[model samples]
Target: MNLYSAVSKSPHRSGTCGPNYLQRLLRLDSPGTQTILSGPESKAMTHYLRSQHDVIIVGVGTAVADNPALNCRIEGVGLKGQPRPLIIDPSGRWEVESEKGLAECVRLAEEGVGKGPWVFTSLAAPKRNQKWSQALDKVGGAYISIPSSDIDGKKDLDWSKILEKLAQLGMSSVMIEGGGSVINTLLQEKYLHLIDSVMITIAPVWLGQGGVVISPPRRADASGQAIPAARLHQTKWQQFGDDVVMCGRIKQ
Candidate 1:
């Protein structure tokens, strides 16, 4: 696994430090003090997905919230082949409204190159104001529904079935980028084989508790111990302007 950080460039050099190190040192008031090296990380992720994953799986929240084009383009890093896009909208409803200049599903539909977009939803058609499903259909994307009855009295989601479906559609590997809840569900089910994260540190700003990028506590056992503890596979450090990027991989 390759980990990369997107940070700003600065004259001062700060190496690998804990989460609290930034707040204790720099001033938060400076407008352009924080540097984000979005180029390299974005390029790395795109390349990894294109090379390894046959499909890209994202939760509806990511689609509605980020509205990412989900294409392969590295702003400064360059461009490469694109991968197929898969959205998991179990209810066939898209909850977020599109805002101008914000990431949205519509934007992705418009700019998506190569394989276009494919949505997975349970609804056959739109009901009332829940028209996201219909919109997806209108865009010429395919939708898949997992029969609700398949989970009857089952504690675990039938990931085997999901994998089978993806396999049938020619998806060998899946890269899941997500909102917290989706990440939690996948982790809970022990379905995720790999995680690639770009950890960045910014000066001054630190919010104790708020929105988290990743969620679901590392699995724990009945003995109050963590089950299947995650082990670090690799770590890479690089300076992007003022910030440092830490890339790590977890052994499956």
Candidate 2:
């Protein structure tokens, strides 16, 4: 996974941190990004965000790919109150028996190190998936039924709806850790207005065709296949171990 040779050859022109940069490097259009990222540098960045934000969020793809414990993993560095793990599992695909299931979250809750993860599934999830929801509850994890009866398709979790719901639940801020599709959705939906900071890590690996990209084949609009684009404000970058951590403020 030498990201340098793979990604350096295809650099982003915006010099901003977001899906375009991610696509240029990793060719992924969603949030499932942990695999291509560097271990030490990536975890350190994840820990810092978990410590800072009130909540940490990942799309379901990421949840399955990483099965990551959202809390700060480092031993000594810790936050006063742990950031809650929030997964956008709209389809309820995580099986109870899977290794990356809610098992780790249950363990953490039992150990008192962090609160159990919150699983957000669409209200219209298949009736058969109810078992998974029940399993999440059985493990002390919370299930949030997002109100999306109007639509049954993939774009059920509107950005504003998610943010407002999190706010109502007492979350002041959130950090989005994700796969490329999720990141691409945020860009296409213009979620930048609600966001404060944008952070990205470019590792030394190029997944190429073996991996996914951030651009999903969204339904064409009347505007005729125009892909939305955005720019970041107050951009900056620095080295984090072997990775390049790109940081910026989302431009309005």
Predicted model with the maximum TM-score? 2
lDDT of 1 by residue, 17-117 (tens): 21212221222344213223234443453444444445555667556544555554534322224556667766655543344542344445545443546
lDDT of 2 by residue, 115-179 (tens): 67787777776654566556656646677877653333544676666666776676766766655
lDDT of 2 at 153: 59
- The models' CA-based lDDT, in order, is 0.44, 0.57
Report RMSD (Å) for each prediction in the order shown: 10.2, 8.4
Best by lDDT: 2
**Where does candidate 2 have its weakest 10-residue lDDT segment?**
1-10
Candidate 2 global TM-score? 0.72
lDDT of 2 at 113: 78
Measured against the true structure, the TM-scores of the candidates, in listed sequence, are 0.57, 0.72
* Cα lDDT over the full model 1: 0.44
The residue ranges of model 1 lying beyond 4 angstroms of the native Cα positions read: 1-52, 74-80, 95-114, 123-140, 147-158, 192-209, 221-229, 234-249
